[model samples]
Target: MVEIVPFGVEAWLNKREKSAKYDISQSTIASLTMHEVLNLDGNNGQEFYSMLDQQKMNYGWIEGSPEFKQEVAKLYQHVEPENVLQTNGATGANILALYSLIQPGDHVIAEYPSYQQLYDIPKSLGAKVDFWHIHEEANWYPDINELKKLIRPDTKMICLNNANNPTGTILDKQFLEQVVE
Candidate 1:
């Protein structure tokens, strides 16, 4: 028998609810549903009610609709709708990206203390993973020189969380451009 492990932030978050005193987790729809804070106005509520009335609950849309893909693609300046693939959520997206792009023994650099999936999945896939640490003393931002030092000739990927989970630190455009360079 093989042991299966939780693969991403979503799994950890689900487990966290048991031990958590305060519900500070951000990624679940349950939070909104539990709080009864999701406001549906205009056609949104009508469409939802109509779906319920028709008993139309299937798999929803397979691979999302064309308009949905186009909307997601618009977020990236140069990306086309055909290039945008939607998954269950960001965790699924991350897993697919890593599974498709990384091979065993590949070198990967990932930001420290991010969503665990960023690095852990690659490790499970047999990649050599390095953490570019972000210091709390330095307002949780990673130093560019330190990041540069972590990169090696064999590095196949650099994974990051733009707005970090748990810390809520945002990586700005300048820093992202520096990372790209």
Candidate 2:
């Protein structure tokens, strides 16, 4: 039986706030107010409003604006503007990528205690999900030998978080290169 995952951390905090005066469960910093946001980089909201007024804002760019795609492409080596496809956010990108790649009966290895979507969604979609654990004793890094053992010829994808969420354990450059090999 497939177990439904509950609403994520924010939903838990919302319920907690209703019952308790102090909210200590939140992982992220307090959100900034509109007034505080408008003053960013000495911007007085006028520049933002002027830009908004200049656009039709009807669905905007389907494949993201050429300028926006060009700027995002510049962040990667040997990438061009045509290579970048913008989404609403991380969730949209993750869903799109996973749904496109993962099929029923495919085998996927996902890192444990990373983002839930990394594994949970694939499992829910009928793929066999094996967890590649980050050992707490070893400072939250996955054992490379264990990873090597987990791989089979049929393994379709290995999902990882470079820097784990909540735990904030990062896979360093040398370790990442080894994984690539």
Candidate 3:
């Protein structure tokens, strides 16, 4: 029985997302109407609407279409299309990855002021979660020395938003390479 704490940001948004006016707190793009979406879609972007070519859309491939996987693989340098997994979305992908890799009593370190789901999910799964706090004085970067201190022989995982979500500050390639080593 997982005793998950109520997600604060989600709860706050659910209570006011529809009713609030001048809601500037939103980090993601505001919802757009179908009409606006249609206008936004370009000449070849009828694909966005899945302009049906009378193709029977069954469950399709278990790992998504080969073409789709290939296209996704193109975005990465060394990744193969076969290695590219097509999940429902970011949250679903996160859920799958965390559930697959995390276990009860495992030690996990996640960035502070990140999407709560990253840390909260691990906690709910019985992981000992630690906050790797980011500082505004350092442009929201977490010191590598601090991270080294957090690491232990028993540490199971270190979760990061990659491109610090909510704040939108990116962890450059060099910084990530240093973390890897």
User: Which candidate tops lDDT?
Assistant: 3
Error of 3 at 110 (Å): 0.8
- Residue 125 local lDDT, model 1: 84
Model 2 TM-score relative to the real fold:
0.87
Which sequence of candidate numbers ranks them by lDDT, best first? 3, 2, 1
* Arranged by TM-score, best first: 3, 2, 1
Cα deviation of 129 in candidate 1 (Å)? 0.7
Q: Could you tally the backbone clashes for each prediction?
A: 0, 0, 0
Q: Per-prediction RMSD in angstroms? A: 3.5, 2.6, 2.4
Candidate 2 lDDT, 98-150, residue by residue in tens: 98998889999998877888898888778998989899999999998988998
Model 3 pairs whose backbones collide: none
Q: All candidates' TM-scores?
A: 0.79, 0.87, 0.87
| Model 1 C-alpha lDDT per residue in residues 1-181, reported as the tens digit of each score | 2222475657776789678887777644453562233235455466666656987557776778788999989888999998888798887888889989988889999999888888888888888999998889888888999988989999999988878876889988998999999
Single out the weakest 10-residue window by summed lDDT for candidate 3. Answer: 43-52
Give the alpha carbon lDDT tens digit for every residue of 1-181 in model 3.
9988898877998999779986865666768887777767675447766766657778789988999999999999999999999999888899999999989999999988898889999999999999999999999988888889999887898888967877878999898887787
True lDDT of residue 51, candidate 1 = 59
Cα deviation of 130, candidate 3, in Å: 1.1
Cand. 3 TM to true fold:
0.87
